[model samples]
Target: MVETSHIYYGTIVHTLSVKNLEIIQQAVLVVSNGIIVKLDRNVKDIDAYISSASCTNYVLHRLGEHEFLIPGLVDTHAHAPQYVFAGSGMDLPLMDWLNTYTFPSESKFKDEQYAQDAYAKTVHRFLRNGTTTCSWFATIHLAACKRLVDTIHDLGQRAYVGKVNMDQNSPDYYVEASTQASLDDTRLFIDYTKAKAGHDRLITPVVTPRFAVSCSTPLMRGLADLAKEYRLPIQSHLCENPDEIKFACSLFPDCKNYTDIYQQHGLLGPDTYMAHCVHMTDDEINLLATTQTGVAHCANSNFSLQSGVCDVQRLLSHGIKVGLGTDVAGGFSPSILDAIRSGFWASKMKKVIERDMHGNSDYVCLQPSELLFLATLGGAQVLGLQDLIGNFVEGKAFDALWIDADRGNVDLIGDLTIFQKLEKFLFNGSADNILHVYVQGRRVSGVPDDENDLASSGDTLNHGVALDHTTKPSI
Candidate 1:
């Protein structure tokens, strides 16, 4: 068993809302059994606070002057197999890109060893970049998908893993045998994930339908029924590009629009989230708000793939939940920090276009705190994990990253305020600035004890235990 209680004296930064950022300087935080138990601001005596907790054997970590804790990033969309080709295939658009680069590359995952190596590197890279939670899209191969789950479990990262489902429009070599086979394999994948880590709620299996263009009507309906039956979250692509939207509407003529295709199949609900609604109609936005479904704003992928810029402000104004996603391979980056930068640019580009073309001079750009909220709490609301891991609250889990603003790529020369330091880290920092990454009190990644090296030796020393391997949840 591992030590269950930990205390830290440092500066704590978290978002109170989209535009409001709360920074507590010289605070004491108490985390026991992976949950934050106490947070006292303006703490003058760390020793007195520790005594008040009545803890003698608990570990107390002190933060440096340049270091502060922020909530871990939540990636709403990413592809596990595609991380191998993240920087490649940027020249092609959505449909041709999928045919040439995506399908062929994903098909190679039929080899279990290839999937294992690729998934390990991908998950490790995300954790190293301080992404504690992710929603991953695996290939159609069930065994390879299961291996992806095993990798995340072994690495001690929180994630929602989905075995991609594509039966109708995919290539012959990569597609499932039939609609029935697709549904059966999806059921099997859900059962495996639940039986493995159901109690911990760390790793969950999501129902993925690939997209409307790739899945048949019968297959989509079946997947929706499975989601309802298992009470699992559903994720898929929606109205990303003009060509993609055109094709999806053509596929289902009976439906009114691209969003209606999924809605007609009983897939739109509070538990479902669709990625890249770049070309959504006003009616469709209203439909999403009515159904309480969320959207994952993948600005990096959209910009790289030549997809249109998504108006996140419009979505937020309409009461639709929104979050950030580093749609790797399509996005060309795995870091949610990169996502935040790209998303900010995407919003500004939209504002500029509106001002120049539509004679709208009052368009507003997204603020830094708004972008931060999209990366953290907004993502939590998207994946239904808001109450557990979004912010630094008394009852929330301690999922956070220790960022050193004075570290590599970010040189703090003069004295700066607390918010100024945060802005520097957000705009100018890289992975080198992340000193330590923690998920549920487990240090998944961090800087090495030796200044010249990384924390490689102890990276896997204390991983979150799988419920399938142990009778009780490991603390």
Candidate 2:
């Protein structure tokens, strides 16, 4: 009965920690100016409560039996430009795949207009899939990178955009002129992105090093220094493939190992998160744990490119922060739900490999709750956004997804527990199940703008006839 702009009454599926999933029934959540102002649980009578609390000037939305609210999904790592050809090429391995599909596609971003069009579609698709926050890696073209930042700003997705740096070990067409020029462009990109953000935390500029093979030592060091000066997060690849690792290690013999290359360059710290640690040693793992660096477990990309499976459990046990990422074209699917399914199977495959191939029957895969955590809270943690978003905590921005389990491909033939409905949505549901997507109290996707009548929602304040608490709310 609180006076608010938006009031949601229904079941809430939220995560308190990595393994703690809470299903709160009959909850009353009040949202004002994109902030969750109040959450009251186990309300016995809605009409009596409205009469008692002097609630007015609010839109009350009574959720359906099968509908629920979950925190918006987060993608810790993705290539924004690679969405152009995400599902076309997948037969080759890591290095060959990069040469065949990745480079040529990325090089096309030199044209600013083309980058804008592609970036718009990419952000739209990710938003439709319920990803409210994403960390994006753009190609080395500064002009196109700037356009990408503008596109994301217009679309209203919380994101971290990085202009890539590759001064050496790249194709002649796509390589930068010099390390100095690359650093200069990176600094400008950072400044432009910061100005574009203008006090809003929606868009952040990330320092991106494509990988060890592409960037020179000086360029890496310069990027590290820029990150330190700007206090931004850094994203890059690490130990993804054996051949790639060998070539990377060979380039810097003075360093002890592949992970050491970044550590010595001052890029391994709490602000950095490396993608795909599929092949890592104990010393390398220790280095990451010691430095408090984060890891992005791209399971779909690992299987797609024939990279060995990463022991995510082992990394978690070592006290290293871990999250999930859809490596875009390498992952073949942009949906975080797909990442969750692949992560579940990846652990099973690891246990099987140990039991049959190595004669050791000890292996643990990722559970549904853990996968849920990795997609939402853990991804936020990896990007150092754990405090602001990732949960339905009061005072946090109301970034959430309105899920209708009965509206999707899932079929509940009989009565089921509340957790089962969530499982069905996670395992068998698609974007169609999502009725509305809201970021900061504004609906960004789902439920077209013209379909919902806002005046009717305000009827309680004006005419006081209907309560306007519809079963299928478009909030």
Candidate 3:
């Protein structure tokens, strides 16, 4: 009745919280502009309700027999430039990997055309893989970082783009000139991103100090100030590997430990999220909890880089927010679904390691529903976007994925439930299964466009064609 713009009739699955996964079948979701206005479940007759409400002038997307809608995957931590070398550099550790593959690959973004080409492909891959929201770590090259922002803006995936800050310990070929230089470039990057991102929801500028190892004290302090002044989110790596932690501790001798370095510099807060906190001490964990910082649990990267297993259960027990990350190149995938599957196995590995240490494990194995939450709402919480795009709550942006199992790589057998189908898609289904990727009510990715999507007069559907008023909503 409020002048809906789009109507979806199908099953919708999403997590209300960590343990509250909801599956609403035979539902009708209405979108006005880009926000979800109504979600009525168990609609006995969609056509009757449409006529009763007199809802006209809208596009209709009715799911097929084997289709369903899901909240799009949220990738809390990823390196946009590193996506060029995503499946490489696994043999080396974090510190060495940065030098061998990460730095060299990222440094190439200094070329603007190279950056755009790489970023376009990277953003497209993430979108087609159903990562509608991603917190991206772009290189320190200011122009390249700006290019990354423009590419994501043009592509339409919500993102947090950070021009990485590192004034010391980086290779001569890639490191910033000086602390002031790093700060100056970072200020420019933030300002540029803000100017480019006229609105607050789509693209946010983030403060990214690659890690304590590469950042100097003054540089860290300056970056923190920028975050406070702009009210932007902060992201960085922390306690990811033993050797890396050792180097960071050696750099800050006065601090109690590696985590204290950030706390001492005003870099840890609710607006901050650190990736791969695998080797954190109890005190460090407590510090994050007290600071209300979030953690991006990158299990595949941790295992690939020989970084220790992160006890997500331990982090959750302390009430520290946690989400999943691909940590591309190190983890070797851009697909958040891969992150989900890897997260599942990583949690199981934690259970084994805990049992081996304590003889009897009290660790709660991360359930499928909980892992699903980590990929969606939990990741949104990490990026400080929980109220915006995580789930199908009223007034939230409609970032979603349309799953077409029949069109995908799945070979469905007899009588499988929708929930079961989702599990299979999570563990076994590829990007082919995700037929459509939507962000803020706009179709951003997937296979060829649907001919049935009929837009109305005075409506601006990004990819939908306008239809006449006589064209009624059809099944």
Candidate lDDT values, in order: 0.87, 0.86, 0.86
Off by over 4 Å in 1: 1-4, 448-475
Better of 1 and 2 by TM-score: 1
lDDT of 1 by residue, 1-475 (tens): 5544566778989987787888999987878767898888998876665555543446666777888899999999999999999998899899999999999999999999999999999998999888999999999999999999999988879999999999888899999998899999999999999887767778999999999998998999999999999999999999999999999898899999999999999999999999999998899999999999999999999999999899999999999999899998899999999999999999899989988998876778898888889999999999999999878989999999888898888989898988899989999988888877888877778765432233333221211211111222211
Best candidate, lDDT-wise?
Answer: 1
lDDT of 3 at 140: 87
Superposing every Cα of model 1 onto the true structure, what RMSD results? 5.0
Error of 1 at 364 (Å): 1.4
| Minimal lDDT window, size 10, model 2 | 455-464
lDDT of 2: 0.86
Model 2 steric clash pairs = none
| Candidate 2 structure, TM-score to reference | 0.93
Question: Residue by residue across 1-475, what tens digits does model 2's lDDT show?
Answer: 5334677888898888887987889888878778898888899776566556644556777777888899999988899999999988999999999898999999999999999999988988888899999999999999999999998887778899999999988999889999999999999999999999986668999999999899999999999999999999999999999999999999999999999999999999999999999999999999999998999988999999999898889998998888888999899898898888888888899899989987888677778888888888888889999888888888888888888888658897799888889899999998887777777777777644422442123122211112365333222
lDDT of 3 at 212: 92
